[model samples]
Target chain A: MSYDFMSVQQRYIEQIEAALEGAIGSEEETLYGVVQEAMRYSTLGGGKRLRGMLCLELCRLGCGEYERAVPFAAAIEMIHAYSLIHDDLPCMDNDELRRGKPSCHVRFGEANALLAGDALLTRAFEYALRECDYAAMGYERGVRGALTLAQCAGLDGMIGGQAIDLRFENTRQMTPEVLGTLHALKTGALIRAACLMGGIAGGMDEGQLELCEKYAAQIGLAFQIMDDILDVTATSEELGKPVGSDRSSGKTTYVVLYGVEESRKMAQECVQEAKKCLHDLHIEEPFLYDVAEMVISRTH
Target chain B: MSYDFMSVQQRYIEQIEAALEGAIGSEEETLYGVVQEAMRYSTLGGGKRLRGMLCLELCRLGCGEYERAVPFAAAIEMIHAYSLIHDDLPCMDNDELRRGKPSCHVRFGEANALLAGDALLTRAFEYALRECDYAAMGYERGVRGALTLAQCAGLDGMIGGQAIDLRFENTRQMTPEVLGTLHALKTGALIRAACLMGGIAGGMDEGQLELCEKYAAQIGLAFQIMDDILDVTATSEELGKPVGSDRSSGKTTYVVLYGVEESRKMAQECVQEAKKCLHDLHIEEPFLYDVAEMVISRTH
Candidate 1:
């Protein structure tokens, strides 16, 4: 009864990569050429494509048209890519490498990288809502999807988490409560949005959408806790960037406060909670349970 | 039969300023406090609110509910403020001042300023589409308005122009065609969006929306040309920043290429063309004509 996770994941990644490449136009010699190149370089370079997979898979679980969700899937990936680009800026985390390649700012120069991030974020919305005609996916779903992405990526969500992180860096102000809030807003929001958007696309009612969000929220925290553990235990080559960045930067993380063993236990508990939500929602898909397990199992 | 230009303008400014202030929440003591302060500091500092006025006025001309368009007006101004903040970043224009006050980075460190800009842009869309329920502004209008703002502010528009400007700065590669494309995308696209968004809110058909876009494009170019002329002729006290910045940065502008006298004449011609579009659309609003005239007539 086990699902073939590897092949399904590979197919999803291919679909996502193709959609992402197609989303950014192929005009490199034009006026906005360099920024476009930077965008393509950073977005198409490489990543786990976790958000896109979650979105597309959830949509399939909801029985929504897989083709209709492709743009949304690509859009979320673009948002995630832009965030990483900005997060690696000199003024931010200042990471020089991402996914074993020079970061966007390092490769494209600072100004172009900044504009590329801006362009990616803006174009994500443009691509997602481009087919907002009355006939295409219906206006309601389009608006809902757009709003979910915007709100999760916005002030009270990712950027807000970033501000908190920057302000509290090198300080002892990050308590467990603060850490929970920070991680929830920073990482959980987008993951929750991906789930909710997929649910919306699949015509899930409000209760079902809420269940998806709850499940996503649990996995999101688990994902971050696992990331912290990986940062501490994984080799620099495996992580593609320097390991222990959080410690070096004096930033607080789950593994910093609660050693690796405790963090891993916490991630397992979160995954278990996430699986419970899926069960409560009557979703018996083995992939759903497998993905929750994968959150804690991912090494990089 | 003439409208009271000063009085009408003052009222519009009041409405816009109030809407903008109301749009940004008052939560300065939270984790996101510093970034929110930076957003308010830069967004509420001071600007002419020209884009807001254009959008609101066009909406009125089309007989849409003034209250509904207020969010869109404030949203556009937020986008403008964010752009100015990023433009003034050290990696970008490196300007120290904006609106007679220290820039966002000077007031709030570099990272917070960057986050503030990102938050503002994301929240602009969130705020505009918050009421996308079927009973609200109608999903079609909401989608159209959101799409218009996103497309105009995105890769092929404002960000694209900024890339070209940055790439060609201090270089002799900025041909006339390049300059035209730059201004049209950087400046014209948003203005055109304002007009078209207003038309959409007012329930104008596609053809009428096209006329509003045409009108806006003409005035957008003229506005930029006039800005170039003022940079040469006006004082720092008048423009709220260094007057000869363009020339000193080795950035080519309309005045640099054609002289102030010729640029003024060109601006006037553009205004005339804009008026012709308005007339063709049968929009007898004198305020629209006066606003177009103000583009060329203002000293700063």
Candidate 2:
């Protein structure tokens, strides 16, 4: 690799942060203005911009301008942040701390936090429709990219997965198939969409897009497996919030089924498959390669 | 005026219901499948399909096929249903009934209701992107229409108004201007978007679009005013829920500020202005005119 992966990741993160700020702000002071404040608090605070970065890199690798993907990248990040806020709600995960600070509901109150999540999710489409142009990619490509986003975020995707996750919370009878489907819908769907949308923006043909999807699917599962491994091995300080949360919640995870050693091996295998998929795409950019590696190897 | 208004409304309602069903429904049922069931219950049940009818009618008036507007129409209804579901949450209005049936959270639980709302909201865009083609409406028009939905649904629109509504729940110090902004954001924004999207679908010029917006703005406010009037004058049986809810909840409504007489006057004036705007748009169908009149005259 000619360029440093850390530097590249930092650049995308900064771009995503700036874009997110520009997309949401209040010009007038009103009681309603607190909505924007809650939105900003959850979104602007530091976290891994993995979703947005994947989108940007995939768009570039797909032959589209990285700039054209910035709005979309930021939008994806907004969706992620909203999911976190809602996930931490008193009724959901009941989490109080996020990024080592009070969660959105903790600071903004429950109602405002909920609205903030709703606002973020809605604004994602708003930005995609108004700012991100298919003309920069292709008209059809733009439409498809946005559609992919909505689909991945909808019932058959993230929401569906979340429902299953919440339902099977205390049941240790989670079959491997259900666990696989659960993670695929909950997290894999959106991650797959990020890469696929980048491919669409790059004007990738059906074959190429399928390859992108294949790569994203592997990395997405691998990413979750690594997360499970980290929960067992990593310190609370390193993991940002409490470690062993999955265990406490009794949430079925890769580590829960396959011991630590096997989970690590599985994540590495998935990353290897992801790299091979990237290689089949016939582009020699090492950026995505490094990203897939980071997904498996990262401690947090 | 030759066609029966009831029949026209029935036709559109049926279409919206069918489209909504097709847009949602999981082929494979899982333990988590109740999300779709909850979505169907709140959405497919009986109610005025007013928002959707507006989109379809405006599309027809603007010179587009009403069928082309069906998917978008259904999407708007999903947005409305989602707003209602979230609005009735324990943290929000805590209502237990809607359209003579148990509120979604009542039947499905708070967590599932929340996910159902989120799913419906997400699926609205999915349907728009996947099924509603601008080829019948022009690509830019399609994009603009979807964008309108997002903006109306986002922080600057419905979510923004809802946040303020929740914040000022017990505070009776709402000024008229603040009240206006609140209603405009809360309900007027979505109504306005419905009309405008119909116009874009119909290929309306800028002047025609502006006329639609003007007509919508007045009718939107009138619609809310009539809602306030019903709250005070109508019975619980007529409303299919608790009447005088605004008073009991300490919600500072238009009727609270202006009194029954003045609020009635304001609503009538809005209807008259809306009819004028419709007239100025050179629409002779009398459908929109009757709809505007219906807005003020409906008892429940």
Candidate 3:
């Protein structure tokens, strides 16, 4: 049987794309125009758009309307976009290429790129907050959902992880625990938040929310490890960015610390854990299950 | 005669300082320790603490409860701190000194500084969300407040202003209108947010909220103009940071575009407008009015 997972993910990506486009519109005032353009530049410059799709899918699975989740899906993607813009800055990663295009700074200049990233990050919350006016969903649930998004995006979550990653760069000894912490905040925080926010938006009870979090945590790490593996194996053409860029930057990765085989095994184990969590939930969504498997198995 | 306004503003600042200390307790682990330390590095570094004090004052004036505004006050300060950290980055403002100490990047390295700034910005929301839950402020209001904060900080507000400022640097002759737009976003947005959020938290009526917004807008610009004037005149020893840094950077200022006398005259007019708004509110407290005047008259 052909695994229809890619098709399902593609559909989800399209939905998120439409939602993002709708959310970013503005009139012709100078300030608003600049903001709208900056937002478009960072977000429209594409990637997998996975954060948004996962959020929408989980919201649907949790019994929330896909429409209700769309704002949040766009918001999370904005956050992801902002992080990429800033990460590519000269003071940071200084990458010239992203998604096969000149980086934001290279295209728009450093000042605009910095401002663009900052704008997108701030706009993420603005989008998430629009959910507050969704009369169909209870206001309390919307507030909780936005709050969850903020927490994940903030210090204790994604930003914190990024700090650790920056601090540990170029160090010869990289501990497993440190690496885990870094990935947890850097990559895992936003993913877990995406899952949790969906559940919260869908009005999941504590138990269902817990299950989603567990699954999300596993897949999030698996996703990062796969990214690490891809850095070593994938070509620039396939990856749409430079391969071996991570190693060249002197940044540590799972493959560097654990070797390729062990790292792959670790990623596989994470997928298995994610699957077990889904199985325990007894939900019959084959799409989410397949997506979990694909998190580790994908080439890029 | 003693200025009761000065005393009252001082009292509010003291209360916010105490509450902020309580809120930022010890870190849980090394990871959290780093996060917490970075937060304190910025938050604890001294400015006038105007934003936090304004938040508490607004809460008290609107809600008649200073205690309830503590988290919001802290959250606003966190946002302010994060912005300063980012603004001082090498690629941004490139300031080596802030508040008489080495900048965050200078002390922590560029990567950690960037992460610290990100964390503080993110944590501001986390702290605010916690308040939404703990204060039992209905979810609708909490979401609205959070959304408002995001809008103020986002592209349409703070980041947008910063973008224009950078774009105009050493390249274009700026008009007063352009300078106003830049200052509104760069400085006015958060100040206005501080006042508005305080009112929101307190559940103020629409009229009162509008008054606070008006007052905040005037004062925010007034504050920036005052800084511009000080940059032209204040010595480094008195200013705590390098004096005339804005001039050195070849950035436009109120004093540069308009003559110093004209900028000073405009600042006074703005202060008068702000006071008029407060007067229309018929508030019992005279100290807030005094604080506004003091803000305009401060030497450093």
Candidate 4:
């Protein structure tokens, strides 16, 4: 059964926020009180919650109970949040704004921010593996899902992408190939994991999971291109954060290489390919389609 | 077939070092070459592979095949290495020497060191979960072992202990209770996890796992007390690293609270209790018994 796109997305976002509040020890201050505060501030402060929603929606479309995926959903968001925190470190991107507020390192000390990222990454595995405790999704799903999550976060994926991105800054290595490889690991890998994990948790067959991954890759790449486009075209207010950040940082982005209009066209093409994957898989989830659209159309 | 303590220890250490070399992508550098190099440098440059040995030795003693525990043994060492990397960060302990060489953050920059720690931690789970690939270990053990690893590494354990240690620096919060809690999380939990995970991998019953935990805790605490004693009693030449670091850092170490003599006596008492647990549980692992002795008597 298809869902009403906006309502389902909104509902999943709310559930994810509440669950994250509970998962992050928000009710009671942990003994790691300052790090806990830092984690909660970075995580619960506010974002689109797109990763959580993507996971829950895919699990639902895979004919699984969405409640069982909630923990994993929140876990992926924590992983995403940790990456953002580390990316904003003074020695890294050195951005002072995230989601319209001072970044974690800007608010907390750099050390606490670093520890909070590590703590958040550690907690993601804890939460992902806890899926084994729930009856609706048993050990097999939990183990596989958690492993998938770990794989995407490791050197082969997000972290690897980040290293390459850092090494290429203000360098002459800004080819289209390098940029594509960079985003594939930096942003696309985790997004792919979010979808793959949901399908795995839902007990989808191998072919179905592959299809989910294909769709995820397309959308993930589209999402990054759209981000690049918005960096050049959208106002800082419209973006809810600073615009022209990519150019100012001396980093190569899709818009920098292909121009804003071409970058916008490329994003739309990716969204189209992503929709084709859903059609081929015969996925009946309206939320998934709308989610793909949101990536490229967010600025509008 | 009980063997000489030294020989058995030497053999296992060799196997662990070789296995870790394989596990940390020794075949080729990862895409994140610098971080990979930092991880390899910190991990392979060993002081003692104590954690890996505990896991493998206990597994062997549990009547399981030693080979089946190799991956996990390598994984725990990676976890230990990650902790050291983060602990040596300029923002943390600010130590420059590890294993008589420059620490990870000193050798590599702070940002790469932080990412290396994250990558190592991520690889630990990746390796631990690969136990699913072996027909001997099976998914049940692999999944359970990994869950236990995550539990020990998360907020309730190592990270939590680290935060407390950081906060209590140069502060008046040094109670016996606080010191007890700090060390319990800082060092004890992973040691406990090492033994308990060995038990879990060997298919030990729940009661047996609980007994393993008890033995682990006593020894783990005693190990920390001995470390404190060594910081005061040992020399830079003997310790192979700087001594008196704990006091210089304004930490509330066991020796600080109870004096060197009392801390030594307390360490001996804890070691004795640790041996008593093995007697009570009828664990016939002589290496484990010797391991407890080595914790308190390593000044030579």
Best by lDDT: 2
Q: Summarize candidate 1's per-residue lDDT along B99-120 as a digit string, tens digits.
A: 8888999989899999999999
| Worst ten in a row by lDDT for model 1 chain B | B131-140
After superposing candidate 1 on the true structure, give the runs of residues whose Cα lies further than 4 Å from its correct spot: A132-137, B132-137
- lDDT digits (tens) for residues A1-300 of candidate 2: 468888989999899888988888644586678889999999995988888888888888777568878877887888888888988988788899898889999998988998999999999988877778666776667777788899998888999999998888898879999999998988898898788877777778899889989998998999889888999899988877899999988888889899999998998899999999988998787888999888987887
Sort order, lDDT high to low = 2, 1, 4, 3
Candidate 3 per-residue lDDT over residues B1-300, each given as its tens digit = 655665776777777667566555556566646656766777773778888777777778876776677778887887888888888887778888888888888887776677777767766776777765444556667776777888898777887787777777786478878888999989999999999988888888899999999999999999999999999888997787888887887878998888789999999999999989888878767766776887888888
Name the regions of candidate 2 deviating beyond 4 angstroms.
Answer: A26-28, B26-28
| DockQ, computed on Cα atoms, for candidate 4 | 0.67
Enumerate clash totals for all models, in the order shown. Answer: 0, 0, 2, 0
Higher-TM-score candidate among 2 and 3? 2
TM-score of chain B of 4: 0.95
- Residue-by-residue lDDT tens digits, candidate 1, A119-222: 99988888888843336457778788888999899988888888888889999669999999999988988898788877777667888898999999999999
Better of 1 and 3 by DockQ: 1
Q: For candidate 4, write residues B102-191 as lDDT tens digits.
A: 889888888788888989999998878755434676667777788788889877888889988888888856899988988899899899
Q: Which scores greater on TM-score, model 1 or model 2?
A: 2
DockQ of 2: 0.83
